[model samples]
Target: MTLDDILNTHLGRRALLKSSLAGGGAALAGTLFGGWIPNVAWGADATAKYETPVVETASGKLRGVIQQGVHTFRGVPYGASTAGSNRFMAPRKPEPWTGVRDAFQNGPTAPQLGGPPNPLILGHRAPTFESEDCLVLNVFTPGVTGKRPVMLWLHGGGFAGGAGSAHSFDGNYLARSGDVVVVSVNHRLNVFGYLYLGGVGSEKYRDSGNAGMLDIVAALQWTHDNIARFGGDPSNVTVFGQSGGGAKVSTLLGMPSTKGLIHKAIIESGSALKGVSRENANKTAERLLAKLNLQANQVDELQKLPMEKLLAVIDNRGQGTAGGGPFVLAPVVDGHNLPRDPWDPTAPEISADVPVIIGSVNTEGTFFMPPDSPQFAPLYSLDEAGLKTQLTQRYGDQADKLIELYQKEAPGANPSKLFFMATAFPGDAIKQAERKFAQAKAPAYMYLFTWETPVEGGRRHSPHTIELPFVFDNPQEQPDEVGNGPDLQPLADRVSGVWTAFARTGSPNTSLTPKWPAYNTDQRATMIINDDWKVVNDPRHEVRLIIESVKGRAAS
Candidate 1:
């Protein structure tokens, strides 16, 4: 029979077939044809389209798509479905499959309370679906032969909601430009990931509090075992993330299990010096159980709760913080899994030898206070009096001093800009850098992204995730956020070069920018990344000190 007749018969039999040739009949037919069915083919176009790339992974063979010389694999499972009995528990290995599975479509995001993307994160798109079986990852590589550097990206949404499959995080440009293997992971999040059932549940649920992080550990293990097939060097892996993803990278640094798995690390904006304390974790657990009308002895019922019912626990709530503020759902510092805080009093000794690149944007706070939001609209148009009133409420006696210092740092700067800078200056980034430097075994490089975007009429000056498109060399993907100016591509080139350079070696020194120095307590040498890149010693030192002083005074 002809191929058309065969396909027509197959389709007639399987009316539920999807467009991607991902149906079970395709694999069944592969045995006869010696190849999987083409994604786009009929009678004449079948031969050319059937030449898609296939890679053998540890779990099974995955059929991926190749576009412009970049082999891209999406929705590749790293772990089993965390549904039913597996909910709130540590990740388990995925079962071995027989036939070639399609890896062309992106995986589902974790069960999260869905919402529209924040207007400030322009061009940002949420994943189309959410499911418990979200322990998947995507890989992009130039070719599946050479041992190129592998970069594992963790997406940001403060651990509550986000998927690595988001369009903004596509690794095509990064993989092609850097000639590296890029992997973006989709792990559990929100209540499904970090419900803190260790203390309340039975012995089997001991690691439940930090299950989300354990999912990442499983992904790392998968990478170590299977990344080589995707043209990645297992030894030269770099764990990098922005915002909550960055906090995850920080949390992984302290993890005993992550030793030797990660050779390099990068934290952008999100600096998690510590995790949710066990006491707080227990409290959150108690609150959740109380809300569910369940007792500690009946904690097993948590696994049976519907995903949407559990997600409603944090409904209408903002994203949780690394330090367990706002919402209680986050990675916990359970004694068994997390052991201790990642970087509280000191950097984790587990990753003492791992080099790190830590940084934040110039106006990180502007993201949270987008002009379009009604709650934050007033802050954008704040006068000097309003700034003083808000600062006084926060800093008390030290408000005027902070205002003076910020004004001196930026003459003619608006009150709203000053307020955001004062509040959003991530002290944790500096703390992480200093603590890493204190380790003495590995060097820590510091940077401050000062490149402003023309988005929202320049209201968001170097806002959070502004460096993301640049770091991924994907300015065109998020044109609204990064803008399509003449300077965008060049900046993206340099930024992405620095990141890939760090992944290739331990240092970020490349021809893309000038000589960057290691961060120290004295020099505090930080690379000011902008159109005119320059190394600045303690940039805005006085402002940082004054803002820090408020904390000191408040503590005193």
Candidate 2:
């Protein structure tokens, strides 16, 4: 079979199978255990699909399902669904159920346009699931016991098109060896999640603009209140995510509401400093309601509208931020949900009490926008000269200086890699974000993933989310899961061990490796993960200083 067939083999097993609703019993084919070899053709073989597997939770006894080896739960509402009646409203508690709730399948995903399309996997049908009742969360736990550290994961689809059960977040190995609990959550997104109806005199949606964010907070509450049953700790939780998830974590750092909910954070190639403000959020909401010819009080009409029409309107101008791009749906500074731009508020200082692990890949902007994209007109015009001009406009005369810096170290870096780094690393208030927490005395640790894969042309050198498989210990590149071998397995074991150690004790001390120190503003040390690892001071120190000192003076 070809790559599609091979991938589909996993798609069917991982999603369709393990996600079967007979309480979600058929979904787990092999995605959970596939992390071992990273790239392994562990084809889906239909085995037993349990209607429900009992789990002892803090709230009492609970029964879930076992899909393949990975235990799965579906449609477990973290917050009340924001459907017809509750459209654009502050998240309310999901009703507790007495009878066993069928969790064989996942709940609906919030409506959105396809983000950074994964044609290889998500080629099924672009926009399918859409609804207001989308505030659901899923949990994947292994047999490991005794209050494991929980990894509360949020998906990345630009705050728009993604669900908690996407293929990439299989939690089997993470739960098994790391002895951690992994949860992927679903919340209101896009128009339904971000609509600012609070000023529209609508009682129902009085606190809307940041409803989606509130949904996330609600999920964390659920974890705190309920996660002890599946042999996981409610207190020792690490909130982590990629892209949009990273941005959310950043925003949460500044939200007084998020205090005491989580103890640690890990941001992978995403930051919210480049997100929405209250003014812009309200403006966007007004425009959306104008299209519907309804006011916030007309919540019923808005909720009743089909999800397709709703999303088409929300995405009218396309999904991304103007300075950014489409794959970043964000929270508005609603005062309640988000008080200010996370970077401007110095969340690092606000969350100084919480340990943090934040990083960006060498080339983080690649996967979201293809190198061959034509939409980047005016700048990346067909002509090379125009592209250079566009580059200069964005980076100023410093464009060449920036390129020189990247070229010096990343000599073999491809055009795509160059573009990605210049835009992301030290980009979008990241340098400032680091500075904020560094000044706050937060025990922050930093890193840069520099491994260029042998597959995918190696040009994407740890592009955007490449560190995921390494973090998860799953390499998805090789044909049919034929992999980079079990040699790297130790790395996963080691890193995850460090992570757990930190969660349990607040420091990543590993007897197997050298002592990982907490971050200090003076040294700014960072851990570098490659085939082999090293602890190094900032990799982009020179570039960071240059950008900081010459920022306003640089080109356009």
Each model's lDDT comes to 0.82, 0.62
Give the clashing pairs for model 1: none
* Top candidate by lDDT: 1
lDDT string, candidate 1, 470-504, tens digits: 99988877777877878999899999999999999
Alpha-carbon RMSD of each model? 5.9, 6.8
Q: Give candidate 2 misplaced runs (Cα > 4 Å).
A: 1-53, 56-61, 67-70, 119-129, 295-300, 317-329, 348-350, 371-391, 412-419, 428-433, 436-441, 476-491, 511-514, 554-556
Summed backbone clashes in each candidate are 0, 29
Error in Å for residue 41 of model 1: 6.4
Q: Which window of 10 residues has the lowest lDDT sum in candidate 2? A: 29-38
Off by more than 4 A, model 1: 1-52, 316-326
